[model samples]
Target: MIKAKSRPFLKHGKPERRPDLMNLTDSRIIGVYGAQWRGYLQYYLLAHNVWQLNRLQWVMLTSMLKTLAGKHRSTVSKMARTYQATTDTRHGPRVCFQTSVERAGRPPLVTRFGGIPLKRQKKAVLDDRPPAPMAGRRHSSELLARLHCGRCELCEQRADVHVHHISKLADLAASGQPQPQWTQLMVRKRRKTLIVCPTCHDHIHHQQPANTPT
Candidate 1:
């Protein structure tokens, strides 16, 4: 049997200092299915900074400890979509993670499911009649902060303000000039955007411009 020093990730231990947050001193010998898996997880998490993960993301990752690759992909897809998370494939197969919101002051977290068992991804079918180019990229953090202004842009409502991008993503990607930056901070710029409340964002998406509350 291969001996690997796996951290007690699945252990539900109380915080040593506060009611929330685990102690960094906590480490225990746990049985990994094999040495290869143990090494893969350690490298993946360490490279991505596991200490920065939020509660929901950490919970989702721990739940997949013993899952197979196919199940892992399916679960990851569902969870990523639900959480509006980002996905990447740097170390292995594919890892889906979340980004920090500047307004909320939240930390970022990453979850990787790729290993030896991961399968190749399938390609999406292209439409013969593609839609015209529109700026579909997400709004920048700076732009979002400006739009928020402590209230909804359209109705000026104070609750649950959100930013909406006005341009199509394809146009933005095509136009954005590549900038030199750290791998994590790299991004493409969008030309146009709008910041609005949840209601206004939904209205814009539904093509109901007139019904959108001003």
Candidate 2:
């Protein structure tokens, strides 16, 4: 009797991609592989020989492209040609694969790969705390620290403050109408997200302009 062949992806110690992910969209496939690449990079970011990870990068990139092209029954080079984009980074311009998912009332979530630098940080200090004004913190870190305090930026309340977001600033200007206070704040602040108390958020959503506290 002849033995039945096992699926390659199901074989022991095989380097096959996940069969469960065969039907996911291109963006999602990229996300899965991008997470793998990012996690790998993060774990080895401090290694002295971190630059050598470029070989693994190539392997993973090809694996991702092959998975994607296989799903669509197309060639790897065709898949590369379709989703490839040039992104400018601190290191300079590099070709990356990219995709976006749009929401009805929110800005599109953009995903890309191959832009991260693999340089080991000599002065790297990993801090688990929320952002403080210390040497290693970005300005956005301080913003996150403030968010964790549960203080409303608009009303200065000490209660549950939440993020209020709109699709984009251009969407606001497209209406050509007087914007609500929270919307006005977002425009003035040049951000699509606003931090406000529930009360203020309700006022903004309900458009209670006459008595809105902003």
Candidate 3:
């Protein structure tokens, strides 16, 4: 992972095998014309109430749009050089859009990334429920990685493996809250989970007993 202190440049490196992440490859059409594109993007941002994003974020969003629009891969560096994008040194090498020609209108010049809206979880007011049964579930990838040191807990499959949950905290709590989506987990949740491959996880879940294999 590149340090925030170091400026990120366009460079390709060897792909690291991460057992926790599920990668998907697909292509989409991004049809946004010059004037119409800007208008649409601005409207999207305003609709989401997230129009005040920084330059780097805007560049990333614009790049994605442009890429989907069947244009060349435009990047932050290219935008900075060509669009006269400014840089902010207060934190790190973050590109600023305040000085660019694209900086106009109250809704910002970039569109907000589509994301899952989070609902504030309500706390239990009165408690008088039976003790929830211990439900065995998978654990967090980070926790599993730390516990087994990036190796599958079952067969010790080190490469191209997946994170499995031994026991779920939410299941144990039985809070009745809807399980968060994968994107929500990526953004916020960080719980200790199990690590296993697809075959191993299926085997352990079906043939073998849950939380039995140590």
Poorest lDDT segment (10 consecutive residues) of candidate 3: 22-31
> What are the runs in model 3 whose C-alpha is more than 4 Å off?
1-149, 166-192, 208-214
Model 1 lDDT, full chain set? 0.34
Q: List lDDT for all candidates, in order.
A: 0.34, 0.64, 0.33
Q: Tell me the TM-score of model 1.
A: 0.21
Candidate 2 per-residue C-alpha lDDT over 1-214 given as tens digits, one digit per residue, 9 for 90 to 100: 0011112222353334554555444566677677656666666677898888776777667767777777666888998998898888778887788887654457776777677887897766544433222121243643564465466767867677787766667777666578766666666656666777899888777763333332
Best by lDDT: 2
| Index of the highest-TM-score prediction | 2
Task: Order the candidate numbers by TM-score, best to worst.
Answer: 2, 1, 3
TM-score: model 3 vs. ground truth: 0.19
Alpha carbon RMSD to native, model 3: 20.6
How many steric overlaps does candidate 1 have?
8
Task: Please give, for residues 50-103, the per-residue lDDT of candidate 1 as tens digits.
Answer: 333333234424433222212223444464454343344454443442322234
Of 1 and 3, the candidate ahead on TM-score is 1
- Error of model 3, residue 135, in angstroms: 29
